[model samples]
Target: MDKPKVAADSPAQVELEEGKKYAYCTCGLSETQPFCDGKHMSTDFRPHVFTAEKTETCYFCRCKQTGDAPRCDGSHKKLQEPERKG
Candidate 1:
Protein backbone atom coordinates (compact mmCIF):
# COMPACT_ATOMS: atom_id res chain seq x y z
CA MET A 1 0.00 0.00 0.00
CA ASP A 2 1.07 3.54 -0.57
CA LYS A 3 2.08 5.64 2.37
CA PRO A 4 -0.60 7.98 3.65
CA LYS A 5 -0.02 11.67 3.43
CA VAL A 6 0.86 13.57 6.57
CA ALA A 7 -2.19 15.70 7.22
CA ALA A 8 -0.57 17.11 10.27
CA ASP A 9 2.24 16.30 12.63
CA SER A 10 -0.18 16.30 15.53
CA PRO A 11 -3.47 14.97 16.75
CA ALA A 12 -6.90 16.44 16.20
CA GLN A 13 -8.89 17.16 19.31
CA VAL A 14 -12.51 16.17 18.84
CA GLU A 15 -15.49 15.56 21.01
CA LEU A 16 -16.94 12.10 20.78
CA GLU A 17 -20.37 10.98 21.92
CA GLU A 18 -21.08 7.71 23.61
CA GLY A 19 -22.03 4.89 21.28
CA LYS A 20 -21.50 7.13 18.31
CA LYS A 21 -19.68 5.62 15.39
CA TYR A 22 -16.91 7.55 13.74
CA ALA A 23 -15.18 6.86 10.48
CA TYR A 24 -11.56 7.85 10.76
CA CYS A 25 -9.70 8.77 7.62
CA THR A 26 -6.86 6.36 6.89
CA CYS A 27 -5.98 7.71 3.47
CA GLY A 28 -4.97 11.08 4.85
CA LEU A 29 -6.59 12.56 1.77
CA SER A 30 -9.82 13.57 3.41
CA GLU A 31 -10.39 17.29 3.37
CA THR A 32 -12.16 16.72 6.66
CA GLN A 33 -8.85 16.22 8.43
CA PRO A 34 -9.02 13.28 10.86
CA PHE A 35 -12.44 12.13 9.85
CA CYS A 36 -13.59 10.35 6.73
CA ASP A 37 -15.66 12.23 4.20
CA GLY A 38 -15.83 9.47 1.62
CA LYS A 39 -12.73 10.81 -0.04
CA HIS A 40 -10.88 7.51 0.34
CA MET A 41 -13.03 5.74 -2.25
CA SER A 42 -10.52 6.49 -4.98
CA THR A 43 -7.59 5.20 -2.96
CA ASP A 44 -6.69 1.82 -1.54
CA PHE A 45 -7.29 3.11 1.96
CA ARG A 46 -10.32 2.56 4.10
CA PRO A 47 -11.77 4.45 7.00
CA HIS A 48 -11.36 2.97 10.45
CA VAL A 49 -14.56 2.51 12.38
CA PHE A 50 -14.41 3.78 15.94
CA THR A 51 -17.25 3.65 18.40
CA ALA A 52 -17.08 5.96 21.34
CA GLU A 53 -17.52 4.35 24.73
CA LYS A 54 -18.14 7.58 26.52
CA THR A 55 -18.91 11.16 25.80
CA GLU A 56 -15.63 12.95 26.03
CA THR A 57 -12.90 14.69 24.18
CA CYS A 58 -10.41 12.53 22.36
CA TYR A 59 -7.39 12.97 20.20
CA PHE A 60 -7.49 11.51 16.72
CA CYS A 61 -4.44 10.75 14.63
CA ARG A 62 -3.92 13.11 11.72
CA CYS A 63 -0.36 12.11 11.01
CA LYS A 64 -1.61 8.59 10.17
CA GLN A 65 1.43 6.97 11.79
CA THR A 66 0.03 6.18 15.19
CA GLY A 67 0.66 2.75 16.69
CA ASP A 68 -3.00 2.75 17.58
CA ALA A 69 -5.32 3.15 14.65
CA PRO A 70 -7.50 6.29 14.65
CA ARG A 71 -5.94 7.37 17.90
CA CYS A 72 -3.01 9.60 18.55
CA ASP A 73 -0.09 7.76 20.14
CA GLY A 74 2.40 10.59 19.90
CA SER A 75 4.20 8.74 17.14
CA HIS A 76 4.45 11.96 15.20
CA LYS A 77 7.19 12.99 17.60
CA LYS A 78 9.44 10.37 16.07
CA LEU A 79 9.35 12.15 12.73
CA GLN A 80 12.68 13.76 11.98
CA GLU A 81 12.89 17.47 12.62
CA PRO A 82 14.28 19.60 9.89
CA GLU A 83 17.94 20.54 10.30
CA ARG A 84 18.67 24.15 10.95
CA LYS A 85 22.00 25.56 9.71
CA GLY A 86 23.23 28.76 11.20
Candidate 2:
Protein backbone atom coordinates (compact mmCIF):
# COMPACT_ATOMS: atom_id res chain seq x y z
CA MET A 1 0.00 0.00 0.00
CA ASP A 2 1.22 3.49 -0.69
CA LYS A 3 1.62 5.96 2.14
CA PRO A 4 -0.59 8.96 2.27
CA LYS A 5 0.87 12.26 1.19
CA VAL A 6 0.97 14.79 3.99
CA ALA A 7 1.68 18.50 4.05
CA ALA A 8 4.78 20.25 5.46
CA ASP A 9 3.81 21.42 8.91
CA SER A 10 3.41 20.05 12.41
CA PRO A 11 0.93 21.14 15.00
CA ALA A 12 1.20 24.56 16.58
CA GLN A 13 3.03 24.05 19.87
CA VAL A 14 3.47 27.68 20.77
CA GLU A 15 1.09 30.22 22.18
CA LEU A 16 -0.66 32.90 20.23
CA GLU A 17 -1.49 36.48 21.21
CA GLU A 18 -4.97 37.17 22.46
CA GLY A 19 -7.50 38.64 20.10
CA LYS A 20 -5.01 38.51 17.30
CA LYS A 21 -5.81 37.38 13.82
CA TYR A 22 -3.31 35.02 12.20
CA ALA A 23 -2.92 34.19 8.54
CA TYR A 24 -2.22 30.50 8.11
CA CYS A 25 -0.80 28.82 5.04
CA THR A 26 -3.06 26.44 3.20
CA CYS A 27 -0.38 26.03 0.58
CA GLY A 28 2.63 23.92 1.50
CA LEU A 29 4.93 26.07 -0.64
CA SER A 30 5.32 28.61 2.13
CA GLU A 31 8.84 28.84 3.50
CA THR A 32 7.25 29.80 6.76
CA GLN A 33 5.19 26.70 7.32
CA PRO A 34 1.88 27.16 9.09
CA PHE A 35 2.08 30.77 8.08
CA CYS A 36 1.77 32.70 4.87
CA ASP A 37 5.18 33.23 3.32
CA GLY A 38 3.84 35.02 0.25
CA LYS A 39 4.43 31.91 -1.84
CA HIS A 40 0.76 31.88 -2.73
CA MET A 41 1.19 35.01 -4.80
CA SER A 42 1.50 33.07 -8.02
CA THR A 43 -1.35 30.69 -7.30
CA ASP A 44 -4.90 31.27 -6.10
CA PHE A 45 -3.89 30.58 -2.51
CA ARG A 46 -5.49 32.74 0.08
CA PRO A 47 -4.46 33.41 3.64
CA HIS A 48 -6.57 31.81 6.35
CA VAL A 49 -7.49 34.02 9.29
CA PHE A 50 -8.11 32.72 12.78
CA THR A 51 -8.69 35.07 15.65
CA ALA A 52 -7.03 34.10 18.89
CA GLU A 53 -9.54 34.58 21.65
CA LYS A 54 -6.82 33.98 24.23
CA THR A 55 -3.15 33.21 24.43
CA GLU A 56 -2.73 29.53 23.77
CA THR A 57 -1.11 27.07 21.43
CA CYS A 58 -2.96 26.27 18.26
CA TYR A 59 -2.20 23.98 15.33
CA PHE A 60 -2.23 25.48 11.87
CA CYS A 61 -2.32 23.42 8.70
CA ARG A 62 0.86 23.51 6.61
CA CYS A 63 -0.31 21.12 3.93
CA LYS A 64 -1.75 23.27 1.19
CA GLN A 65 -3.93 20.34 0.32
CA THR A 66 -5.55 19.81 3.68
CA GLY A 67 -9.32 19.98 3.95
CA ASP A 68 -9.03 21.14 7.54
CA ALA A 69 -8.11 24.69 8.35
CA PRO A 70 -5.80 26.00 11.08
CA ARG A 71 -5.02 22.45 12.12
CA CYS A 72 -2.33 19.93 11.36
CA ASP A 73 -4.79 17.21 10.37
CA GLY A 74 -1.90 14.75 10.57
CA SER A 75 -0.48 16.00 7.30
CA HIS A 76 3.06 16.37 8.58
CA LYS A 77 3.18 13.26 10.74
CA LYS A 78 5.56 11.48 8.39
CA LEU A 79 7.60 14.56 7.55
CA GLN A 80 10.49 15.53 9.82
CA GLU A 81 11.93 18.91 10.55
CA PRO A 82 15.66 19.69 10.47
CA GLU A 83 17.47 18.74 13.68
CA ARG A 84 17.84 21.97 15.58
CA LYS A 85 18.24 20.62 19.06
CA GLY A 86 19.68 23.13 21.44
What lDDT would each prediction earn against the true structure? 0.84, 0.60
Residue 56 accuracy (lDDT) in model 2: 79
What residue pairs are clashing in model 1? none
The TM-scores of all predictions, comma-separated, are 0.87, 0.65
User: What's the lDDT for candidate 1?
Assistant: 0.84
TM-score of 1: 0.87
Error of 1 at 81 (Å): 4.8
Which candidate leads the pack in lDDT? 1
Alpha-carbon error at 73 in model 2, in Å?
Answer: 2.7
Q: For model 2, how does the per-residue alpha-carbon lDDT over 1-86 read when each residue is reduced to its tens digit? A: 12222344446555689988888766555666667778767766677878888987766655444457776567455445541111
Instruction: Kindly give the number of clashing pairs for every candidate.
Output: 0, 1
